[model samples]
Target: MQKILVAGPTFPDVIERLKQYFEVDWNQGNALSGAELTQRLADKDGALTAGELINAAVLAAAPRLRVVSNMAVGFNNFDMGAFNAVNVLGTNTPDVLNESVADFGWALMMAAARRVVESEHWLRAGEWQKFQYDAFLGADIHGSTLGIVGMGRIGQALARRARGFNMRVVYHNRSRVAPQIEAELNAEYVSKEALLRIADHVVLVLPYTRENHHTIGAAELALMKSGATLTNIARGGIVDDAALAEALRAKRIGAAALDVFEGEPRVHPDLLAVPNVVLTPHIASATEATRRAMANLAADNLMAGLGEGPQAGHPPNPINPDVLGKARRS
Candidate 1:
């Protein structure tokens, strides 16, 4: 049987499923370091990972590696260039977690706009004595303008949710989505600057790319309305956390919410100091059902890519499909 490494903690049931087809080396503990991962993968033929870095150096060490299936929609962890060069198939689980992540994005936006986390922390500390009508005043979601960066699956889901709130949706993406989709969501395509200027609440759903680094920086933040709220459900480094923290501290923008931060799980010290922001450890796709779906899909991708399952030789979500039939570099 082909040997595979499971590099992150996952549902044991998924492990059992994988075990039926491959010799599985599952790591149920903390994430393995690069050196440790290289060592463990040296003898493996394939691997299933959740946002673990899989690059050229690691590939060089794992001469047998032929496929890598990532559980999350984002394959930013995988070095696509290296995978393509080595003809190692790469796949990611997408679509399944879109709604769940969109739900979380909405939750984060509401939490920050309404000061949920800040007020909760105060209440927990026994600071609430009497209800002050003026205390924790926040922007209203209803009948407001909603700006979404990256109008992809999750972005559209968020826009659709805005209908009930009577929000006017405006989005800025690399390219405009289909006109039918825009009509369904009641969304309008707009320039990033226009979105910043008009939106009362802004949520980022863009993918991380070299060109997209710090997509929202000091300049973009400055462009937003003074009372506007900012929310990020996108990848870390997409926003300048330090700049955001400073803005929050100075009340340059109303409030902010972040689910992903640069160099996380080590957040910027300045962000932690600001009480106007809500922060969460990247759990946007964390609902039990959604996570299970992700795990199952990842398992399917791994098995199928390795030509061992119902969808043998046809993985549902191949990131680098060009490498599918190419001879392995090793």
Candidate 2:
């Protein structure tokens, strides 16, 4: 049988499914270092990974690696140029987790606007001796302008939710979404700077890319309303963590909530010291059902990319379909 590596912790059921077609090597513990990942892929025909870096060096070592299926919607960890050079198919699970992620983004925005985390921490620390009218004052979510940085699926979902709160929605995207979509969501297209200046709440849902790094930085923060809340459910590095930390420390913005960070699993020390910011380990698409769907979709991509499943040679979500026509190493 052709061999494959499940390069990160995943559902056991997903592993069982992969084992039906390939010799499966599964890693269920800590994330592997770059060298270890390269070493393991040395003999594999395909891989199913969650954020494992597959760069030029690793591809050079993995002579037989024909495909890599990433379990999340974002494949920023992938070195697409390397994959293309070697005709390695790359796929990601998308669409399945959109609603779940949108839900979390909305929650994060609300939590930040309402000072939910700050108040909870204060109560837990026995700092709430008496209720004061001015205590834990936070920005209002209702009847305010909501600015979304990316008007993609999750961003549209967020815009739809804004209607219930009677909010006016404005979004800045790489390009404008269709007019019907804008009408349906009651959203207005705006410049990033305009959105930052006028919004009472801002949520980021854009994908991460080299050009998109630090989409929100010191200057962007300075443009925001002093009473506005900022929330990020997008990939880390989309916001400059250091700059955000400084803004929060200076009360430049009302509060901030982050679900992703730069150099994550290791948050910035300044952010930790600030009491107004809310931080969560990246878990936006973490609902049980959504996660399972993502895992199964990834498995489908892996199987199809490896020519082992019903959709053999036609993975549903190929990041680089041109590779399908090229000679695969496997």
Candidate 3:
């Protein structure tokens, strides 16, 4: 039987399913260090990871590795160029977590715009004597111009939710989405600068790429309305966290919320010190059902990518499909 390394903690059911076809080496403790990951993969034929880095060095050490199944929609953890060079397939769980992530994006936006976290902190400190007329005043979500960066599936889902709030949706993407999709969602295409300048609330849903690094930086933040809110549900490093922290401290923009951070698990101290920001530990798709679906899909990818399971030889969400027929193993 082919040996598989299940990196990071995952549902037991996913492990059991994989055990049906492969010898499983499950890591249920804290995240493994780089050396440990490389050592473990030395004897493995494939791996199912949840954000562990699988770069060229790791890939080089794992000569037997043919496939890597990422549990999340964002496979920024995988070094695509190396995977392609070595004919190693990488797959990610996409649509399964779209709605859940969209819902969380809304949560973050609302929390930031309404000063939810800030006010709650104050109230908990026994600072609420009486409700002042202007206490915790915040921007309105209804009748607002909502700007979305990267109008993909999750972005469309956000636009759909905007309808109920009576928000006007404008999005900026690498390329405009289909006209029919825009019409269906009543969304308008705009330039990134235009979106930043005019939007009452800006939500980022773009994937992370070399060109997209720090897509929102000091200059972009300065373009936003002083009272506008910013929310990011996308990958980390897409926004300059330090710049955002400075902006928040200066109140350059009204408020900001982040689900992912640059060099995360280690947020900028400035951001933590600021009171106008709401931060979550990258759990935009943490709903039990959605996470389970993601895990199952990842398992499916690992099985099929290795030429096993019901969908033998056909992984559903291959990141580099060109490497399919040329995989090193199988």
Candidate 4:
């Protein structure tokens, strides 16, 4: 049997299924360091990863490696050039986590718009003696303008939810989504600047790429209305955390919520000091059902790409299928 490395902890059922075909080396503890990952994959034939960095060095060290299946939708951790040069296929689980993530995005947006976290902290601290008319006054979500940056699957789902609030939806993407989709969601395509200027609440659901680092920064924050709320459920580095902290401190923008940060698992000290912002440890796709679906899809990709499962050699979500039949790097 071919040897496989599972770079992160996964569902036990998924592991049992993979055991039927391959010799599995599962990492159930802390994330492996770069040196440790390289040493471990040195002899493995295939691996399933979750947001673990896989670069040319790791690929070069793993001569037997043929495929890498990523458990999350974002594959920015993958160095595609290296995978292509070595003819090693990469895959990710998409669509499965869309609704779960969308739901979380909405939760974060509402929490920020309504000052939920700040007020909750105040209440827990015994600061609520009496309710004043202006006490914790916050931006209203219903009948407000909702702007979404990066109008992908999750973004569209968010737009669909806005209908119940009677919100006017505007979105900015690399290109407009189909007319039918826009009509169904009642989302209007607009420029990023225009969306920032007009929106009462803004949510980010875009993928991260090198060129788009800090998709929202001080300048963008300056463009937003003073009462607007911002929420990001997208990848880290998409927003400048320090800049966001400053904006929140100055009340340049009303409030902010983040599921990701520039360097996370270690949120910026500045953001932590601010009371207007709500922070979560990237649980946008943390629902049990959604996480299981991601794990199973990743397992399926690993098995199929390695030519062992029912769909042998035809993994459903190949990121670099062009490398499938090419010569493997020695």
**Deviating ranges (above 4 Å) for candidate 4:** none
193: Cα error in model 3, Å? 0.5
Worst 10 residues of 1 by lDDT: 321-330
Error of 3 at 281 (Å): 0.5
Error of 3 at 259 (Å): 0.4
> What are the lDDT scores of the predictions, listed in order?
0.94, 0.93, 0.95, 0.94
Off by over 4 Å in 2: none
Model 4 compared with the native: what TM-score? 0.99
Taking every candidate in turn, the Cα RMSD to the unseen true structure, in Å, is: 0.8, 1.0, 1.1, 0.8
lDDT of 2 at 74: 92
Clashes of each: 0, 0, 0, 0
Write the residue-wise lDDT of candidate 3 on 1-330 in tens digits. Answer: 999999989899989999999999999999999999999999998999999999999999999999999998888899998898899999999999999999999999999999999999999999999969999999999999999999999999999999999999999999989999999999999999999999999999999999999999999999999999999999899999999999999999999999999998999999999999999999999999999999999999999999999998999999999999794832
Candidate number with the higher lDDT (2 or 4): 4
Best candidate per lDDT, number? 3
Clashing residue pairs in candidate 2, if any? none
Mind giving the per-residue lDDT tens digits that candidate 1 earns over 1-330? Answer: 999999989999999999999999999999899999999999998999998899999999999999999998988999999999899999999999999999999999999889999999999999999989899899899999999999999999999999999999999999999999988999999999999999999999999999999999999999999989999999999999989988888899999999999998999999989999999999999999999999999999999999898998999999989888777896
Stretches of candidate 1 off by over 4 Å are none
Q: Candidate 4's residue-wise lDDT over 91-144, tens digit each?
A: 999999999999999999999999999999999999999979998899999999
CA deviation > 4 Å runs, candidate 3: 327-330
Error in Å for residue 134 of model 2: 1.3
Residue pairs in collision within model 1? none
